[model samples]
Target chain A: MMRPTNTWFAEKLGDHGIYTQYMEDHHPAHMPCLEIRLLDWQQAAEIALRLEMRLVAVWATEGGCHDQPDSMFAYMGLAHPEHRHVLLRTQLGRERREIASISRHYIAACRMERHMQDMLGITVSDIPDGRRWIKHEHWPEDALPLRSEFAATTRMAQAEGSYPYVSSNSEAVCQIAVGPVHAGIIEPGHFRFLTVGEMILNMEERLGYVHKGIEKAMCGKTAAAGIRLAARISGDASVGHSWAFAHACEYAAGIRPPRRASYLRGILCERERMANHIGDIGAICNDAAFSFMHAQMQRLREDMARMHKQLFGHRLLMDTLIPGGVSIDLDQRGCRLLSEQTRMLAAEVEHLRTIYADHPSIQQRVIGSGIVSVNEARDIGLLGYVGRASGNYADERIEEAYPPYNELEVHVPQGRHGDVATRVWARFEEIADSARMIIRLLEQLPEGAVSNAWQAPEAGTSGFSAVESWRGEIACWLRFGDHGLIDRFFVRDPSVINWLGLELAVRDVPVPDFPLNNKSFNCSYSGNDL
Target chain B: MLKLLKQIIMTGDKSEPLPDSDAIELLGEQLHAHIRKHFAGSLAIRAVDAGSCNGCELEIHATGNCYYDLERFGCHFVASPRHADMLLVTGPVTRNMATAVKMTFAAMPQPAFVVAVGDCASGCGVFEPDHYAIAGAVNDIIPVHASIRGCPPEPADIIRGILQVIARRAA
Candidate 1:
């Protein structure tokens, strides 16, 4: 694979008349970061859009201290060609702490830009939707949680005013507001639907009901302690988020975990993927009122979770991946047990797939319901199963190939139709694929220590890492300050993009089918709210 | 249809016996008696996520699966608080969700019991108390009769916690 080198950035960016000053590649991972003038930020976005690069993440940082003047820096992480990532950085003067919106180029940056506005008090000018993303009037208008001086312990009184949801003036249209407290045993999110009788005209989602100030909580914590918070960012994606955070810290410190640990991390990640996929496959069916498939799938999922607990001491695989490497190892007995279980799962999943395909009732509910066109999917830059089901293939495992994945064979499934049925099929294929990967990992288990000693990186060192979690790519960036404490941390979960996919897919569908469509996407509330 | 029937027959009755059934029954002669008397031999629960990481919700969902089969004990999850005899709440109760949690608790009928699940709901867990976004644990927002303590309590532990709440009400 030909990676985009630092010099390559200078040559390519210079052609667009955009001046670039390349920063030293201090981080172990070879991610090329370029510093550009704030005026050229929109130009950079245009170039990235022309190159068909996805805007991976956007964040703002307050880089000031007692000695230096207060300044704000905005960063945009873009997906580059050949499994590489390029970060564009520009410093903003404190007097005019504002940046132009890049959502004009990347639709996926809409919510992320709004989120930076809410958390850091940075103004994103000229965005289509200027509504607050994560803020809900719970704090003072001036209080920005991510600002350097905003105390974490400051509690505030709640203020009142409904979110300015986009509404239509048609008298025939009826509006239905749901959630923040749903009927199901699920996370909290508000969804507003404008409908006439049964068909949905428009669907708007207002999330962040599960926001617990995770980024604000992560500041000043040690790298080891940060992993615990990262793991809990979204419970089901613990392995992916924690591993990404740990990888970032390790990259900054210039330490590579042992081969055995990397192998174990890979196996654990696949197991997490298999668990979530199995649960979701059943859930989608359940939402379609197929109780038989739901019950059976839940049974299979529960059994797999039990196996995980027997092997790694946690059903959800939380706190398993730490800063240096994995915290748990499997002996020969565990390996044999896992292999046997994998065989059972593969056969059972194949049988279930046949039943799901043959059932006419399930087909009627999912075949053409809640479709996201390929163009909309590409525009939103969806990832993981949702992206693959919609003809957008962006799996970090195959593209980035970090650690054990580079040594393994990855088969990423692709689908042309972006409907509920295709999403379910994508999950089934991914489960089988993950099972195969897990078995391969166990067979070729390496011999070495599972973890290495952690060393503190020098102050001001920053690092970034991206991992293909079950849902999608989880990208993490962090910097170390004095005394080895974390100066700043920002993470982007794939749900931020896929949630837009859900909103797009639900248009013109019956309101009754919203559950099925939502289950098919299964975007994480906490992951996005953070 | 034939394959479906065959598949069902082959799977058989997978609802396993409740974990620690003997001990629960011994203490829950009160619980069974309470359900039989007050709830007419059925317990209706409405689960609320105050502001959890959703780890606790997964365990609660598992209790509804085939192996746990929580309905066998005359306990079932209800979609509305108005129909609930108990409220199963989770998490540190963030500022954004605190009002919803209160409204949910207020909607339930009289003699309703609340079981705070997970260490986060019980006492803020790994999160800092009274942080800018967090309003504190479940108890700080509303009165909690029973609390289960764990990063995320297992399904079996959730059952035990729910039973403990009911048994106390029975007594």
Candidate 2:
């Protein structure tokens, strides 16, 4: 029997220089959860594996008495089906601050540990692979990114030279470097593809080409400013990012949004999901050279965007969701109009899907184009439609059942094939499901204030909140300072887990299919870059 | 040939429809009003990413989504500055992207509106000071007309920013 609270084995492990306790604070939105404090990093790793906690995020915070500047805090999130969350906190000092690498146990920790290493200058002992992740070798080795004392205005006097990419020795393996600047108008990322002829033998992606110093800029910002930062983490997922940040702040502050506001939030989130799905379906078809489906999907996507504009007065619904509640509301006439549009759109989608299913060319191109087995998906901990397509149905909407999602009986559409076609089908299914959910939510739309006045929490309390964005689970953790401002905030986007699947899915597929495979996963590069 | 002709007739003529002369005059007036209100008469704009850290790029990409219909306004993101009316960039302008940023700006045609979308772009947002690669804010590289500040600004803010630039040019 798996009870929610009994999921973690941390209770049985007991006091090995680590303080394990559940934090139930009402002030911040994410307060009512479990927190474990470890005196050292090795202890954090032991408990993480022993307790079977997934490494959600690893972020460092500069600590010490206001005068002494060398203390650091490394935070990690661990979870099980039984307990909603288990937070692991470790404290480190300048003299003896090395932690054992947990990347061996949890593969997800690889990038996070590297990020912490680059930012905080923390040493991870006995790591199998220790190549620089975010930090290029061109920069001074002594320069730590997340240090509080690091000067902001100082510019590097000399232009650093190019980074040396690692070479491969496998037979017929030649490296193909693509993008920091691509042919198309897109964000920058460096992809080193190791290929023999057309087939990709292995692929190594070097990102951070767009690394904006987001974490550093976050310091000294007010809660409102932080929400703006959160929303910007990934522009397409603004509602999700803002909701997650606000959810954390609200948890720390112990504020609940008005019921109507929560319902409206659901509506906005569904719209975001629908818009992305429609665009992606089109893009995927375009990648497959199916021009007809591509054009139709684009038209459908445009229609949805128009509906969004008519309702929210913004096409992407940016900044519509605030900390206490939503910034916009739907009137009776607007609600009626939205309901009608949704019905029409739903019918159009069904008709288009029929065309897609009956088209042999589309089916042949997509059916098993980029097959990621269920086992591989589970092992990699894939998220959203990509994960759902491979039978890993972990939707935060259904699992956590927060706010409006709790009101509507949400059914997550899942598939077993785990291929491009299956992923597309799953996405379509979710789109329809979201439309239905939106209709239900609108019909029973609550009437109340859309927002509540918010105040920062008093010092030394913390909280965590996880929401299912269109992509997957987005978890936010927050700690309040004495002055009622946010002391520490950490967010983990679904892309962090989903990107790993890309490396696996692209293996052995010809370079031509890379676009198709990438589109099927459609993980946000910006979301993960954080 | 006969079957094709019949099919075309049934589909109500496949060729481009010719405008009626009387209605054309009225339609032209409406078109002018719409263009004046929306397009801002061939204004040039440049995009600068102060230090996005790329979340904004996804939403920026969303601007091209059929639903958002950014092209309907005659606004398009151009690759080269020699032909570009605007420079749309994302991220915090890392040490690496700085030179590219400057080069991009230099390449763009003058009288351009520079729009900074995302928090990192506007104020370096979260990726500031301590980031190893960042040079500074987008303002450090180029003057900005409007700043859509989100971690990544929603596609709506982006569209709004474009409209604001056009509106200012028209004014």
The local lDDT score (0 to 100) that residue A225 gets in candidate 1 is 90
Top candidate when judged by TM-score against the true structure: 1
Residues A129-170 of candidate 2 have per-residue lDDT tens digits of 676776665666666767766754445455365665657877
- List model 2 lDDT by residue over B1-171, tens digit each: 343344234434222111233443344344335456644544333344434534566567666654455555566665456666666666666775676677767766675657777776777765654355677677777776677777556666677666655555555
Candidate 2: which stretches are off by over 4 Å?
A: A1-8, A12-19, A22-53, A64-70, A151-166, B1-92, B102-171
Question: How does chain B of model 2 score on TM-score?
Answer: 0.70
Kindly list the per-residue Cα lDDT of model 1 for residues A269-309, writing each as its tens digit.
99889888988888888988888998888899899889989
Model 1 stretches with alpha carbons more than 4 Å out: A1-7, A64-68, A81-83, B25-30
Q: Which of the numbered candidates is closest to the native, going by highest DockQ?
A: 1
Native contact recovery (fnat) for each candidate is 0.81, 0.37
Model 2 per-residue lDDT at B15: 22
- List interface RMSDs for the candidates, in order: 0.7, 5.3
Q: Tell me the TM-score that candidate 1 gets on chain A alone.
A: 0.97
